[model samples]
Target: MPPTAHHPAAPPRLDLTDTLVLFDWNGTLVADTDRALRATNAVLTHRGLPGLTAEDFPAKWKLPLAAFLRDLGAADPEAAEQYWNRALAAEPAPLRRGTARMLDTLRACGARLGVVSAAGAAAVADDIRNTGLDDRFDVVLAGVAAKTSALLSQRPTRPRAYYVGDTEYDIHCARAAGYLAIAVTGGYRPAHALAAVRPDAVVDHLDQLPGVVTALHAKTPAPLGGTPA
Candidate 1:
């Protein structure tokens, strides 16, 4: 059986608790990225644009749906915006699991929190508010526009940071911003895909977050064998 990780790693273990933990909204904390994709593709296909199959979806995951549509050959910006708006009307279900408890745990531990996702501001803010998880974060940076910039913007005040997301793009964003990138298998991508990046740590469950954080700041991380951190 896989070893269980129930708590955050202790100090002298690298005080990751001191660093603010920034998360990617869709996959990291909640499980709505797939729902968004389904909604998006439905509209795209109906509007005469081809929908993305799972194989091609990965390539477009990090990019905003509007931008992604354009990249997929939709030259009409107005039509793309309308397609996204139609998807939004459906209001995809959020997969927020143990989110409240998890947020409580992070706060009790004295760690700061932030959310950096490709999700738009309206969708991100709406979900955070609806879930009542907004209070848990010191910063909630969403929307494709703010994805990488949010982390870079916060680094001056909170130098020690960790980015938690489900995609390789999130890790790429983290690396670009110089923060520890922690990927969760629970999100958009599978463990193998996220593992390919060799993030500071990879978690299968939301509850394992503390341990993930601990490992990030850990002086010696059980020898991360995949990609460089």
Candidate 2:
């Protein structure tokens, strides 16, 4: 068996000061969540597999594709893979709000940015690259089996961290990976669901985001050996 890698211990308190901010692409930063879910469900229905419904999507949304599909009763790996491939091929639109300004705020504040999503790397790369938001993050990770694992892989470059996302998966990932989690109410799962994971904070809109980060991660530059990064 492959050796398991261990993650470092988590901080006792959730703090965002001078920390790197990681985001989940689909529901957090981009609007592709609905599009992808819809497409995937379409594939599931067409293949005679049970379709993934929005009401039930979040429950299994965190699982990696292979396992998620298998657990959902996609009898063959080939069929499951094909469904996802077709859905990705649709080339959907991105999250409509805060795509530009929010990123600018983070960068201007000197906060480093990264992404971790269950979405496949190739597809996420293409979306980011093509949409031009790819340049917004210093690091972008895809095909992450779990968001926690993805966050750990970049520990060398990221500072004390916080993750911004829209589902329980994101919150769970942040907690498991030793980072502060902040849930956004713009997507599939309800804010309450995300709160169930006990995220450090939660936001109802994107405009209020900067303040949330500010309040949590006050280690702003002048004191942290760097300026507000």
Report the number of the highest-lDDT candidate.
2
Candidate 2 Cα outliers beyond 4 Å, as residue runs: 1-17, 52-60, 77-82, 219-229
Superposition error at 105 for model 2 (Å): 0.8
- Which regions in candidate 1 have their CA more than 4 angstroms from the true location? 1-17, 53-60, 64-67, 77-82, 220-229
Clashing pairs in 2: 16-216, 16-217, 17-217, 17-218, 17-219, 30-95, 31-94, 31-95, 110-229, 221-228
Clashes within 3 Å, all models in order: 0, 10
Which tens-of-lDDT digit does each residue in 204-224 have in candidate 2?
666566667666555333332
Q: Count residue pairs with overlapping backbones in model 2.
A: 10
Q: What's the residue-level lDDT of 149 in candidate 2?
A: 80
Query: What tens-digit string does per-residue lDDT give for candidate 1 at 1-229?
Result: 1233455433333333446778888767776656667766876777677787766665565455566667767777446755664565357456556666666666677767888866667777777877677678888776655467777876654446778888888888887877777777756676677767788767667766866666554654443222221
Q: Supply candidate 1's per-residue lDDT for 227.
A: 22
The estimated TM-scores of all candidates read: 0.78, 0.78
